[model samples]
Target: MSIKIQDLPNRAAFDVKSAQDLRTQFAKDPQQGLKAAAQQFETMFLQMVMKSMRDSVPQDGLLNSEQSRFYTGLLDQQMAQNLATSGKGVGFARLIEQQLGRTVTSPGELSAPAEAANTAGNALPLSTSDGRHLQYRTVLNNLPTSASYGAPAAAPAASNGDVPATSKDFVNRVWPHAVEASRSTGIPPQFLVAHSALESGWGKNELRRADGSSSHNLFGIKAGKNWSGQTVEATTTEYVDGKPQQVVERFRAYASYEEGFRDYANLLRGNSRYSDVIGSQDGTEFARRLQQAGYATDPMYADKLSRIINGPTLRQALIG
Candidate 1:
């Protein structure tokens, strides 16, 4: 039940080489349906593996301090540094924590600190007339010195995952791996945020089983019988031709949000159904491709998703 940071297995290395080769192979023919199918198969395989890991790990709902899951920094080092204590980056920490037997603590939390300063208008040279100590809010030190306060502290909107670190108060936490998923997998963070918001109602849905049990899913992704992962029964909406058709199905729950996000990225990146979506990191493009690739059955799914992302509420949460 206890896992030290050093003892946990490192699974961050994404084997994109085979994916690259598969992409090349898909390009050679471009005619065969093999490309799309290959992607889904690989994604399914990955999901199954994560499912296995989730099932194998036992949780008494106690996260040991010494038994922590260390997040490797493939992106930002400071985020990695912060994660060393809180245990995650913008996107990955959530995933890593889930694998280590924890669930996302919060969702839909972010803030903009600069506006307060802008509203203040050159106040006290932001404290200290020398202006020598003026630092960006993203890296504000928590020292007791007068320099740490009254000024808009570094309001990092998102550090890892789709969640930003701009907000000082830790109300909601993200998967942290969402950043890795967005940056490394090129899924675009906003899109991921939009999906998360829509899927689990910002982590306020039936993601859990009424008890504090692991649904193994943060996004409320439905489960197919063939899927080996544990399942949670929930009322879900199925998108059909851009319209949300109602469907109550058994959804696949991730042991952690990070795993869910990672699997979602792999599913898109590896599947040919999402080929129209590949290399297009734009949130809108990503949305369009999701519909085109048949990921969502809703007719207005893309529009709804893109609108939410472009809206002021989500945008405000994203930036500091």
Candidate 2:
């Protein structure tokens, strides 16, 4: 069967239909399918790169309008598609095709690489001034379901606060505090940073005060009746009977990020609930203990936190 690349739907955006179609094509002709899939990955990567470049430029000029921006986006998408299909894409597609050809034996095995490609496009910047880009060395397996802990549940909603534009910024800002917290709790500094990133969406979704200041509640610790600290009220999602429900709750606030980290360390050290969490060097085990001890209501909390701790996002941010 001759594969018609032009017939693929949602080529520029992530869609379930596109993935299904790719799998079907792979079943018929593995060689051509691998090429097509690689091209698709390159197209997504190029689009993300172009979008990031456009975002960096000022958009407040008089000539910039909503319609113009919309059309410009379309133009970028088409350009990305053309570049990938023209066989001259910055070598990403070629590299992916070669890599897949060596290890991929059946169509069923294509999902891992396909999902990894999608994740890479979403989580990575294509290039920096030094011409460095994020590289995928291997395909990541699907995370295990949260059934071991209890019924499967949705991930928690992100906290409401400002976030840095890049992962590097997030890591740099929190590294010192993470180090201090790690010293007190015996948890790895990167683990603490990853936990904070999961809770606050890499500092983007932290709890904020009425005046739009940060609550500095990096761990999402709530204000209880015995607590006498400042608090910020925010709507948060809690899992009830395996369903998500939103309710307002008061979270502990801090004067600074250091104070927040210090409080977090104290909580882990002072409370008996987190006895297993302290001094745990392994990221996966630490996250698992936190969930098992009712750190958050999200059933997938441990899995989500573990992903950040072990995933490429943190690795890239730390290196960059």
Candidate 3:
């Protein structure tokens, strides 16, 4: 049962507390009412999702490509439905604008903030709930003073089917996980890092959730099921064949880096869609196969990944 918003004593200016509130409103509600509610919340959720899409959503300004078709399809059809059903779009957007002190013109404009949401656990410069850019002091405070609970987990280093060097500790820490991700998901390590860096700013983004809590999520991977960690209710994308299909989900969080690293690594290893890359023994071939296998929504996703890997920034992030 969803709790009534009024039942909650003190809520931030634009907070909606219970699924029941949404359910009573939309999970199962009358058509007219749902439409009205969606009108109100549509803008707000768009604000949330736009934060991520601003960067990820291609802006060639023309939707000639299949990727653009899928992207727009999600925005116009899928996301708009959520706004009507949730019934808090205006209020939420208003709150964000108030805190950030800038009006969000379109959902796409929110990419910076969404990307910033990825590295909430580690030190990263970001905006506060009230919308002020600041250091990641909150992250430092959330970490355990001692590793009494468990040992620090380090993912295995990624070998390019050759001798894997360990000179660059920064890249080394994530490469193991990346290599595993590449091997399991067929998403190349550089592609994953570039995406992660774009998503979380190399552990300097998403210091916390909108609710003022530690969200222990890396890669901004949302909670799907069997999640037993901190959570943030937010709108995110659901990709089908690498195309955005628009999904608003509750994301799970972690308390330690080990948990996040392990979960991400395993996510790829376990999912069968990514099984082809498992121990394939070729980097470029792995990338090509992933694309051919329809790993992303875009018909040209493999091409994009190739370009990203071959790009200067991604190459440096990988080898350095």
Candidate 4:
């Protein structure tokens, strides 16, 4: 019996068995199979866009309830699938099909496109509960390929001398300052260091002044009305409704790294909102409290910070 795209039932968003069946059909008949796979990808992409749009808008109307939201989500998913298969889709399916066709030459290359299709179908909508998965992927993607669970070689120091030559260098350079900040705040020094590393990308991505000097704002503490210090204007990423958007903002500039750490500690110590974060000994609790205290706008901030504190990258660097 010949397997036709129309013969297959419309698969659920995360149906692994259905994905496997699609790949099986692909092996038997590549042309129709490719079209089915592309449609599935387009459906998933459209659903994600719809979910993001829904999340951006407030849903606190009188008629809004969990039951209503659930049914609305179902409607969105069905609509996505229908639009994808209707031949008048957003053209994503056509684009994917065309690209895959051009790249896929041999039977061995089939698995690559098949996996791509399956990944799209298996994608989940962004939510607070799902932030850990996003955090893990972000950490993995950001990790240095040269060093996996080990100390990486030193990069050339920047001409400005603020950037560290390696992760080990970063730890050594900031350890004393972190310890000083830690003593005042009653937070662990490692936690402080990890937080700074997460903020600054281990000092390599520190904000710069107009003269290309380091802003020394490792904590990403923005300039507020009460602040009386040098400032730097730079574009920074802020997450709104779980989506990252870049905006230019003024940030506190420091004369030295130690001053930056000192100001960061003082900010937390002085602000009543950060009371829970001040004395946190556990890395996870510290990060969670910081996020709750409105330290950063990034939705995955806590998870990302906690991962850096507990992950092998920092540990390996510290030992090295």
Ranking by TM-score: 4, 2, 1, 3
lDDT tens per residue, model 4, 49-71: 89889889999999997558756
Which regions in candidate 3 have their CA more than 4 angstroms from the true location? 1-192, 198-208, 211-216, 238-247, 280-300, 318-320
Candidate 3, residues 155-231, lDDT tens digits: the string is: 23435322223223334454444543443443435455544444454444533578655464555676667767677
Better of 3 and 4 by lDDT: 4
Worst 10 residues of 4 by lDDT: 142-151
Task: Give each prediction's root-mean-square deviation over alpha carbons.
Answer: 21.6, 18.8, 22.2, 17.3
RMSD of 2: 18.8
TM-score of each: 0.46, 0.50, 0.36, 0.51
For residues 1-320, write the lDDT of model 1, one tens digit per residue. 32222321231222323223322322332212132222222333343344456447664456722123211112222222333323332443333323322111112211244234434432211222233222222112111101001122234334544433432211123423454465556544456666777665554553666565657465555676668877777767776554676777887767766687777777767767776665443456567667777766777878987787657655454432
Q: In terms of TM-score, how similar is model 2 to the real structure?
A: 0.50
Count clashes in each candidate, considering only residues at least 3 apart in sequence or on different chains: 51, 2, 23, 0
Candidate rank order under lDDT: 4, 2, 1, 3
- State, as a TM-score between 0 and 1, how close model 3 is to the true structure: 0.36
Which 10-residue span in candidate 2 carries the lowest summed lDDT? 143-152
Question: Across residues 1-320, which tens digit of lDDT does each residue of candidate 2 receive?
Answer: 54476554334432223433544455555566666667766776787699889889998899997557756876786788788877767898788777666644444344465555545542221111211111221221111111000001112223333456667667756665675676677676778889989989888888899999899898899999999999999999999987899999999999998899999999999999998788665567789889998999998999999999879888666544
RMSD of 3: 22.2
| CA lDDT scores, all candidates in order | 0.43, 0.66, 0.42, 0.66
